[model samples]
Target chain A: MTLKLKLHTKPEVPLEADCICPDRMQSLNMTEIGDLVTYHGNRQVPLKNFFECSGEFDGEIDIEGDLVNVKHIGSTMSFGKITVSGNVGVHIGAAMSGGEIIVEGDASDWVGPEMYGGRITIKGNAGHMVGSGYRGSTVGMQGGEIIVHGNVKNETGHVMRRGLIVVAGNSGDFTGVNMLAGTIIVLGEMGIRTGAGMRRGSIICQTKSELLPTFTRSCDYLPLFLRHYFKHLESLGLIISDSLINSPFERWCGDSIELNRGEILLYAGK
Target chain B: MKIKSTTIVDTFAEAFNMYVSRVIITADSKEWAIAAAQSITGFATSVIGCKCEAGIETIIDPNDSPDLRPGVSVLIFAMDAESLGKRLIERIGQCVMTCPTTACYNGLAGGSPVIVGGKLRYFGDGHQISKVIDGLKLWRIPVMDGEFLVDDRFNIQEAVGGGNLLILGKDQKVTLKAASAATKAMGKLTDIILPFPNGVVRSGSKVGSKYKKMIASTNDAYCPTLRGVVEKSELDDGINSVLEIVVDGLTLKAVENAMRVGLMAAIKPGIKKISAGNYGGGLGQHHIHLLKLGF
Candidate 1:
């Protein structure tokens, strides 16, 4: 019996419903789950005030509605799965350690910020900071994967220390900025200042992009490790061209102002 | 049991418990993959002298390989897990890593983890980089061609080794022909390998020797040249030449299957008898009886 939550009344303001997570609702009854506290804007309110909750929790939660005002849904969740039917607000799956979240529609800013482990897949476009750390945090997305099928706004994977972030569409500026370690692959065009202050990590781009001066062009070679990643992404329903997998990439070692150990691989087509 | 002119001797093959590791070596082309595979499996015929027994299991298709490249699967067997791990690092680093356009990966999904690429990464001298995909770590060491990518750890599991089948024929020509046919049939199976030169061994040995320093000597009972001198000769009147096929596999069932398949394929007109080598069932853990193979 999956836990079902359908938004019956659109909140006038953003609702903080972190209690919708599987870890918190797995042991609660329907009435107890409905009575869970959720903050409507700055005021406290029961979850039953805005959303109708039914079904028993069985390691899976299916949420239906526009949920554009729902924030922190599945935050810090360590297990189970959450499937969203419509657009979701900010901070979905933030700091989640395990399980999975699949958003069928567009997502707001800060998707899976500082996530320790788990997977977050967005079917549509995403707002700014797809997998970035919070303010003053040194690391973002320590582990896990964030796959966005559509375009994403700026500061993707900011200060990311570990994990994989794959954007199938275009990406905004400062992609993988200040990244200490991790892998961020953008299959489409990337905006300026990629890997700006990254100390050690890999940022792969399928198309040509103007890079910052801190990065240095190393050599042109086929990276064998990317084939494994491409195969993994292909298994996730992404169409990876044969040419892209077989082509050589221009290896650029960058962030000379920092450790100068990070690398950016830009595709050099056959 | 008689299959045409060949008689299946009522004996068992003694196989010992050993540790095995499967390595997947992929390269730019099938030729280079086979080249690396051949190089790594060299000088590894038997554990008695080589410290390990290894053979190429199969050639993997590009689509089925770990990196979507042409690959060759090779299996190595050692007396223990620690020695198997050490042999993996030594052989992969020296042979596969040194080969052109080759990358090595652990073929087994689960076993006792042994660090191979983790120790081989030092050859890069601080230039090596590590990548983790799907929870499996791989090390990429900078090479003159491009990079040598290898798995961080290879898994070793308990296996069966030293399974043998002895073929007696009218002459050396017919004996070699039957042994070749048997190896060709057994080669199609998975999880097993014939670990001898062209899958046949002529110098079968006994447990002891006349010399004090030697641990093993020739099996005089099966030697046709010594049949008249030795009172306990296993050869018949017409049997003039004999050959042995050694099988090492990841499982006892795999060894039995290969032996069964080889026994069926080796039944020819010139073949006299098909028997198995054993030490009166005193050594080894698994005893594969020829009559109980469900022929």
Candidate 2:
């Protein structure tokens, strides 16, 4: 069962989905007319004010049409699958532990911030802080996997302790600023100051670009461990093709000033 | 009752309780997923010799997998949770981490299996990174191959093991063939999964050994020569061969379904009556009544 919520032509005003019920998502059976939360104006409003609610109690929900003002599609949703057919606002799946979020279109900032588990896939592009630490803290994301198909802004994986963040398009400055742990793989060119203060993690930049002066080059040898990792990246639809997954990587271990356990590994063509 | 001209046994197939967990490994392609599974499940034939029994449960499509890649689900069973955890770490470290484009995940969502990934993360040597998406915690251990992704925790469940029905045939070939056919049919089951090499075992052991050092030994009652003098003999003349199939299931009802289908498949051409090896009713609480099932 699925709940289809269509937010058509809503301008300004952020329609936060903090009150949207996820437990009843799958129970909705989805066959009947489901509930939706659309907004108009520049003020804050509850979710129940917009769309009419109706449906069975199945564990699934879908958001159709344009949702430029809709924020937090599946915030803190533990179970159930959520699909968005069009573009969305900020905080797509903040703190989501279980369930899946599929966005056929692009998304705004913080795609999957602090998610413990679950998955979020964006077909188009994503904005800044896609999977970064909230407000003042580091330790950005603890768990979960985020796959962004388009370009992203800077500070992508700032202090993420765990989880996987894959960006298919180019990235902005500070690719993985102050990253404590986790993996951030950028398929396209990376902006300046990549992996600046990374302590214990990996940042794989597929494109050949300049790195922050702080990052130190360890060696040119291919890491034996990456053969298995690259292949996994392909399966997730996050990285290079499977046939060329096992290519050699240019290994650089830096952000040496910090915990120094982190590494920025780029695929070095053999 | 007869199936393919073979007599149906009047006895039930007995089973014992064991710990089970499912492991899902995903990689760049179906080939790498299968490769990792084969490596991890290799040399793990049984609890008696290998300390555990494991096999590939099913292949997952990209859409269904966590990473949307080619992946395979494997079921691993052992005598207890400790062993299960140890084997998982050992196998994933050596096999999955070595296989190109492979990432390991806990197939079991909730329950018991001691956390497999949270423990193995130390192997990352401080390079290990964890991710919490949707509530599931995953570990990313940076390996030379790139990175090995795995689920943080694996649910452990109590499962029935050693559920078997011996195939008594005129020759070894016929015995193996009949047993293979039965196992092949049962292997496709969802409730019970066969964790063995090709789903058949030639050596079926018994409880307690004649020697003082051994805890359990071979079944002498089924031995053709010992058939007469054996106190609880279940074999007769012309019964030259015997083979056992072990099934692991989440529920007793699941085991029963497997046995019903297995027994029916076992008794085929060149086969005799089917019988289960049990240490009496005292050993197990869940029992399958052969008569009730057949009727």
Candidate 3:
């Protein structure tokens, strides 16, 4: 069964709906689901005032219409799946523990922040701070995977302890900055200060990335272990070209200012 | 039963339970993979004297291997899981780890878990890194060529060991030939290993020895040289040599299938008779009766 939620009216102001996650909506009836509360601008309002819900129910929830003003679309969802056809608001899969979420349109900032488990795939552009920790938080994305097909803004995977973040398109500055431990693979160009202050983690750039001055050039060779990561990403339906799979990478061990062991791998070949 | 005028003796081959683990060693080429496999399984012929029995089961195609490299699947059998675990860790660490560009993986993933790289990671001292891909943890120990990737743990399960047959012939030339043919026929069997040298055991043993200090001694009953002096010599007038092919399999069906192939291959001319050893059902619990070969 599939649950369909269509926006009935475009909100004049931003609406913060924290009840759209699959875990919270899986057991609720259409009436109960509509009665879920959200803040329209500053005042609290029921979800029924903004969206119309229908369809045979299953673990899959489909959200339709432009949700650019909606927030917390799939926050804290641990089970089931959620698919959004149009643009979505901030914190798309914040703190998600399990299951999967697919966004067809662009997603706003803080997508999958501090997620524990599960996977989030965004087909369009993503705003700033995708898969980053909350401000001043020590850890971000303890587990799970976040894959973006389009360009993303800055501060992606900030302070991530574990998990994978894959950006297929260009990324803004400070990608994987202050990372404790995890893997971040960027297929496109990246802005400045990549892997800055990272304690322990890996940032792989398919194209040349703007490396921080703290990073020292190590060597230019193919790390055989990266094949495991490439094959894994291939299994997840990502296109891993033969050239990229066998390409040599320029290794840069960075964040010497913090005396950390993080590494930045830049693709040295086409 | 008679096949090509050779008689199948009316006896049974007794076997006992053992723990088995299959390890797949992959390398940059088939040569290195096989080189490591040979070293890892060396000196492992029989559990009686050698602590374990191990042999290469088959060659894996590069495309089929997890690392997409040429590989060899080897099986090791011991008295129990604990023994198998220790033997696997020691052998793989010393042999496969020393071999260039070789990575070891667990071939039998669904079997009960047994430690492999968990303890071997100490070789790195302090530089080992663990990567978990698709729920399988692999330990990467930095090496000269690159890194040595090995699964954290292998798997072990109950298996059958000591399934064997004796090939009796008029002379050593014919007896060894018949045993060689049988080994060749059963060598391709999956989940089974012929641990003896060239898959033929010349020194078949009995349970006890006349010397009090020894636990086992040569089977004098099947000794053609002792036919004149021994009171219970089982050899016939023309019989001069006897060889055995011991099988250790991960499953009973695998042992049975290998026996069927081996028995048929040993029935050519110059082969006088086919028999098997047993302690009269007092020892090993599983018995493969000769008459049930059904060939």
Candidate 4:
């Protein structure tokens, strides 16, 4: 009973297809769903213009084809699951409170921005601002989890107050800039100024990086609490080595410009 | 009924409703974990005097432990949830936290939550950090060795306690051997603990004493020395010695299961009879009948 959507015609501009969410399609028939309104770059159009919709919604939606021009696929969805078969556009799962969205390919910027709950997993590389707040917003991604398997651009979790963001590959500069409280774990290399201006939060890196001068080295020890997070990430299909789980981490208390409560744990190795 | 040469007395063990909390202590080595477990469970034999009854439930393998360290599980029982919670705080704070290379965690999944690590974090003098992972909150208190990680709260649940078995034998050595055998078998079971020394109690007691201040006194009926003086001695002439095993468990069924296992293992040639302690079924909430044990 999954609702299947395949792109029949590529859109000339980014299409706002927030109606593709499971919450909105659960009660709609094929014809009614096809008639759903979408905006193709400020032009109002029926969803059937560029995509062929089939099947009934049963709390799950399987969407296929390159969704690079499709934005807002599961916006504000409280429950249910959405699986994108290929590359997805920006604003996917934006502000979603519950449920899960899985992207098989790369994702655009602003993945799960300001999300309260739910999970958004990007199997490939992601654009900038992976789980960040929008411009002029006070908080971002209060809860939920965003896991990216590949590399990510700068400002991965900007101003994020809560929730978990795991980047399995390399990340650009300002990884958790202005973060208030949350956990951002970068398994690969990270760029400069990690956790800059963060009031309270945790940024963990597997590989060493040049930390900002605002952070002060505290001590080197094995934090048993990280074992739980490592086990959880391993369950989510991330490859965590046994040596990494047992390694000692150098604790750095940072963001002295703000609350000075944020911490960055750099692996000290066995 | 006779399993071998021993007779299963037609009596029941009176068990009362109590509160229990399971605490898992993990450490860098099994020795340290057992050290903490032994320290916390010390002086906790009976609620009558000790205010709680506790024992080591099992030694958990590193692979099965929460933090992948060598662990020992201990269960503590008190008269009520509030008292049990207080005992948990006192024992864990003084014993487990003081032990080197030890971290404690709540073993039970569902129960009324009692704050333990939340209170212990103050030992860090405002430097303690809290981390919430997968909805489970943990406190990281800075210590001289490194950091002491503990769960924020431990769960306490309603449990059963005071389950007992009286093993009568031809002599003291034979009785001790039989009781040891029974405890070894019962120790293999989960959700239950034999709280006495080496899982055998020599000085079994009655409800009250002739002294006004003493709420409990030695059970004179089964005392081999008083067999001739006492009018109604439970022990016969051949039964010169007796020992008791007290079981406390998270559930009545678990107590019954442990009792059944102990009863079967205690049936030896020197063991004359296997009896149970009860107050005519007037004090406790549950009565475990020996004859009706469908073993």
Candidate 5:
């Protein structure tokens, strides 16, 4: 069973819908869910006022219509799945500990911010700070996976302590910035200063790009470790071309100004 | 009972409970895969001196392999998980790890995990990387010919070993032919392996030796040359040679199935009698009663 929600009335002011997670809806009846209060700007209003909710769900929730003003849709949901069929507002899936969130359309800023477990798959573009730590916090995305099939804006995986972030399209500047540990794979063009303060973890760029001056060239050879990740990526339905699988890579080990254990691997062609 | 004019012996094959693990080794081609398998299974005929018993289980197609390469599955058996883990690490490290374009994987996935590549990954120095696919951890170690991908652990389970069928023939040539046919048939049975040299043992032994220093000695009772001097001989007057096929399998059913196949293959002309070896129920706990199998 899935709990279905449709926005009957679009709020002019952004709604802080942090309570929209499946964990909160699994126990409430339709009337009880209607009574659950959500903040619209500074005013508190019951969810039934703006959204029509139905379905007897067991561990899954589906939201329809444009949720561009809905914030924190699946935040802190430790279990179950939340699927958004349209564009979602800021803080979507923020601080989620478990379960999966799949977005079929574009997502706003702070997507999956500080998410620690489960997986989040965005089929469309994502705004800035996806999987990044909140300002003043040193850790981000301590665990879990974030896969964005489309372009991503700045500071993706910023201060990420652990987990994987894969961007299929171009990424804005400072991708994997301040990463303490984890892996970031950008299949397309990457912006400048990638892995700027990464102490450990790997950043793989398929496209030809220049690295930061702080990273020193380690070697030009085929790494055996990539096959393990490639096999995993393939299982996720990501196609890893023969050229990339058999290609020799130029390994640059750095963020030397930090722990010096982080590496940036760029394809150098076969 | 007579089958194909050969007499079926009324006896049982005593077998011991053992720990076994199966490993799948794949390579760029069948040749390389079988080479790695042969090397890993070599010198592992018995636990008496070799410390383990191992053999090639089957050849797998490239499409079925983890890396999409031609592969070979091998079964290795020891007395316990600790010994099995040690032998797997040592053999895979020296044989498969050194073989060209070879990758090792655990064939059994769901039992108690025994460490394999988890320990071998250190050979990569600092370049080794680990990835979890479908919740199974695999390690990639940087090698000269690309990378060596190995599963982190292999499942181990209790199994049966030393299940045997003895062929007594009119002559050495007849015994060899019968044993060859029996081995050929038993090879088709899954989850079992004939671990002896050529999958046939000529130097079968008894429980104890006449010498005080040796724990086991040759079975003089079945030796045609010692027929006259021995206290008792199990062989008939025309029987000049005896060949034994020992089966080690993942379960008692597997060993019994293999023994049935072997007996069917060996019960033919030129073979006078078919029997099994046992130390009067004193050796092993698990017994494969040849007559009770009704094959």
Candidate 6:
């Protein structure tokens, strides 16, 4: 039978399960799939104390619960699909490498951080640092994609190395700050200091941008390749749609500190 | 079948296997787009002479193309997939990429897939950016005028080449005029393109060379010279000049349309007779019977 871990009740002290990414558990042939995991007196506690667990060993696992205070719900999982029906805590899919994880609700800060590859989708607002590097670290998301339907907190992509991050709503301050490379597209008006001190990569904004002084103003023209690229992305079931991203733009290049070559394309004025 | 006393051949116009690619160049206006397309598609008539064949496929409306500007689709073909790929890279990199207000896009959707943007991204000097929209990846290479956006990859497909006809005219002037008229008429047809210099060639060649080292030589059978030496001349008594138009297509129907339109226009005042060159059906597996088509 397919194993299931059900959280029938709420928890205290914001439970921290650091090694709980969906990418890691997809391959587990757990004979004891119903093990209740929790914390007790500063150490790890049995999950049976709070939730009722059921079923036998199987490749698939269903995690059902209101994990609002449960941090690191699915940090890295590979191969199987994990569906979280309710809101989650911090570091939701940190450093994920593979498999598919779906959070039916909001995710706390650092969701899918340093993700090498995999797919993480949140149907609600995502916390700050959606795909950023660890504090004091240089590299950010190298690969993978995160789609957030709601608002995002600040510093969404600090020092990102690769991959795509699409936000359908407002992006808070410091979005794509010092980004080394990769793409961070915001459908709404960009907050101040967008792409501040960036070196390489692209930050496509649907709304006019509030540029940082470091980035030099570049010419305005229709970039032919961008149009076809948008077309390709649309066919991939990504959030990129013609009506939203297909429009004229003002180009800018700068953050010369790294001898910067990255580009920032702000939406054209109506 | 017959129309206005003109014969509609019951036999089909057969074509040969070829590799094809579609290129879309976008410009500030339709005029410039047309210009760029014309420039790139020039000197492409037939693989036998020019080594490739190409033509403008369609006029793209402003809102319909990339950059929200006017654009046109160009179809190019080569004898094989490798040659098609090589020619595409050369033409796009040299012509479209260098041209102002023009961005190149791939038209054909699938074949031995490769990356164009991934190769051209080196121009960015490590600053090129890639954006994924709807699963399509695009690279933005930093250029002097902001950035040049190009698709990372384009699709390729199998096509047909050497679908052609030879027009016999009274003299050089009349022969050129008829070739021009035929080209004009064939231009209206879609999915098929005539890639060559002015879509016409006077030096049409035959299967083999007279010397041991050569593979192809001039088609003496259609030559006005050596009238007695060349026993089977398709040209009539007054015919002095011959011009060939090669067609490339996505399908047999596409090639047929070009043949019908081009031959009808070529058969006007200065022309004597129209025919195709084939090695007793040996050169290719498929054949186009001129006599049956003229019936």
Kindly list the interface RMSD, in angstroms, of each predicted candidate in the order they appear.
0.8, 7.1, 1.8, 1.2, 3.5, 4.1
A1-94, model 1: which lDDT tens digit per residue?
Answer: 8999999999999999999898999888999999999999999999999889888899999999999899999999999999999999999999
CA displacement after TM-score superposition, residue B174 of candidate 1 (Å): 1.4
**Candidate 2 on B1-295: residue-level lDDT in tens?**
5666676666766677888888888888899899999999998877877898888777899878766678888888888888888888888888888898888877776667577789889988866766554446677776665667777888888887777777888778888888888887887787567777787876677878879987778788777667778797777677888788777776777777887788887776778767777777778655666666743
**Candidate 4: residue B163 Cα off by (Å):** 1.9
In model 5, residue pairs whose N, Cα or C atoms come closer than 3 Å (at least 3 residues apart or on different chains), thus clashing, are: none
Tell me the spans in candidate 2 whose CA falls farther than 4 Å from its real position: A1-170, A182-189, A204-206, A216-251, A265-270, B25-50, B56-73, B91-103, B133-135, B142-149, B195-197, B209-212
lDDT of 5 by residue, A113-200 (tens): 9998888889899999989999999999877888888899999999988778888898999998988877888888899999999987
Between candidates 1 and 3, the one scoring higher on lDDT is: 1
Stretch of 10 with least lDDT, candidate 5 chain A: A222-231
True contacts kept of 5: 0.35
Reference-based lDDT, residue B290, model 3? 84
- Model 3 sits at an interface RMSD, in angstroms, of 1.8
DockQ (Cα-based) per candidate?
Answer: 0.78, 0.16, 0.53, 0.61, 0.41, 0.37
Better structure of 4 and 5 per DockQ: 4
Off by over 4 Å in 3: none
Docking class of 1: medium
lDDT per residue (tens digit) for residues B1-295 in model 5:
7777798888899999999999999887899999999999999998887999999999999778776679999999998889999999999999999999888999996579988899999999977767654456778787887678899999998999999999999999988998999999988778999999879999998977878988788989999999889989998899999999999999999999999999988876789999999999887988889887757
Query: How far does residue B282 in candidate 4 sit from its true spot (Å)?
Result: 1.7
lDDT (tens digit, per residue) of candidate 6 on B35-109: 889878877766765677788888888777765678899998878877777787777776777676677776666
Q: Top lDDT: which candidate number?
A: 1
Best by DockQ: 1
> What's model 1's lDDT at B106?
97
Ranking by DockQ: 1, 4, 3, 5, 6, 2
User: Evaluated with TM-score, which candidate comes out highest?
Assistant: 1
Provide the RMSD of all predictions against the true structure, rounded to 1 decimal. 1.4, 7.2, 2.1, 1.9, 2.6, 4.9
Is candidate 5 or 6 superior in DockQ? 5
lDDT of 5: 0.88
